[model samples]
Target chain A: MVTDKHYAALDQVLELAVLINDDMTRSLAQDGLTVSRTHLLWELRRRGPSTQRDLADALKVSARTVTGLVDGLEATGFVTRQPHPTDRRATLVTFTERGVRTVEEMERGQQEFARLLFAEMPEERLDCFSEALGEILIRLREASRLTDPRGGDQ
Target chain B: MVTDKHYAALDQVLELAVLINDDMTRSLAQDGLTVSRTHLLWELRRRGPSTQRDLADALKVSARTVTGLVDGLEATGFVTRQPHPTDRRATLVTFTERGVRTVEEMERGQQEFARLLFAEMPEERLDCFSEALGEILIRLREASRLTDPRGGDQ
Candidate 1:
């Protein structure tokens, strides 16, 4: 039934996501970075240099959109474009020294933020929560492979 | 140290959020409604007949944004604006018959979505996940109250 507590928890996830997103937006704005921009930077930091096409694929954005993000970041000296060593036609994007610093700062900030949000939560509980979330994520990924726009009939 | 599995879990939560948001966006677009628009509709349905000011507050939007949403809904005969019985200067916003039907459909769609996303989980695990998520929400609400921008940096 819709009144079920489990359903309420699912709804809470959505509500809490909105709140956290607001917080993240404000925090990123202070750094002059949108979440989208920071996300690209984070990806580059994690995966090291990548071609524009690869980034476009990884971020699920259009090639033109990737160019725009890369251009914006490059213009600001947060990233640079280089000819790919393996592929002559494509360009690779990597963090500038400044970009690396921002990624570090963002990562540190996120860690602190997570700790604050989860402070005093017992370890065993978190383990269970983490495992539950992991399993749910796997299920979602699998379910997404099916072609039901309504998510599913079930 | 930062590469710990717990950090990975936290990061997964953000990734999963992006995926879910993308799904919601695509789902809402099919019905000619944006997520923001449907979120307001959902709120109105759950709480019933709120003032524009209250809607703005509840949705965490500006008064002007609320007017725009209400105007759009009103234009489509999905909601109505009428003088408040208690307050002369204020108006109440409530769902029309069409609006109620839309709300019901949206709720059912969301349930189907949730079911698709969480199908086949064991009941005991779901109970644990629900309880864990509930506790995490409480902590998040508590953490949000702190003044420091880095989520209190404590």
Candidate 2:
């Protein structure tokens, strides 16, 4: 039975994500970078630059997420998004001079944030939750993806 | 440590939420309702209408969430927000005639969705996960809510 408590818990997850992003954006402002900015810069450098789609896949994030990151990075002069000449559907994401220099710093900051986020989590449970979450995501993806708006693959 | 798998899982949670919302919105469209609209109408019916802030608190939802709900409901002539003369900042939300008739249908749809969402879950594990999620939400709320951007309760 999915009780009202379950509903509350689900709502909490949504709020928690927003809160986490807000806090990260605020804290990163001191260094002139947001969480999205840092991650995108670091990923671009690590992957030797890539298309937005490839970057999304490599980072295991959504295309919309990558777009948001690129938006922030571009606004901050940390990245440039260029239309890929060979692929009309693709956007090339490459580091700016500033981004190249800051990528290492961003990588370090990313690690620090990750450490802080999981500092109190029990490793065993975190691993279990991660695994469980993976399964749920797969099921959800199957239910919602593969089937297009017309109810079939695009 | 937040490894690649952990990050992947986190991204999955986000995408899953999006997918769940998309599915719900589609399901609700048949009756000229969105998920937030349906939930808000049902809540108002069950809780006997109340101040927006009080309703948000009781539902463990954000003010923004309530605002979105009220936006849809008000647009559809299912609810109204009236200024409280005594409390200058408060807006009381009350169901309209359409809302009263729709509430029962919304409740049924909500239950059907809940059953489908949790059909495969073990009750014991679901309960455990719900508890864990509740704790995470409290920590997130504490970290983010105390320091407001405009530095006001609003």
DockQ of candidate 2 (2 decimals): 0.35
Candidate 2 residue runs with Cα over 4 Å from true position: A1-75, A81-93, A100-110, A146-154, B1-47, B50-72, B81-92, B101-109, B146-154
Error of 1 at A83 (Å): 5.0
lDDT per residue (tens digit) for residues B40-109 in model 2: 7767887886898887876667888888888878888888888886898888898788777777676676
Output the lDDT of residue A41, model 1.
Answer: 88
Q: List the residue pairs that clash in candidate 1.
A: none
Q: Give the best candidate by lDDT.
A: 1
lDDT of 2 by residue, A70-122 (tens): 88788878889888979898889888888777776755655655544454667
TM-score of chain B of 2: 0.60
> What class would a CAPRI assessor give candidate 1's docking?
acceptable
Backbone clash pairs for candidate 2 read: none
Q: How many backbone clashes does candidate 2 have?
A: 0
Model 2 chain A: lowest-lDDT 10 consecutive positions: A145-154
Clashes of 1: 0
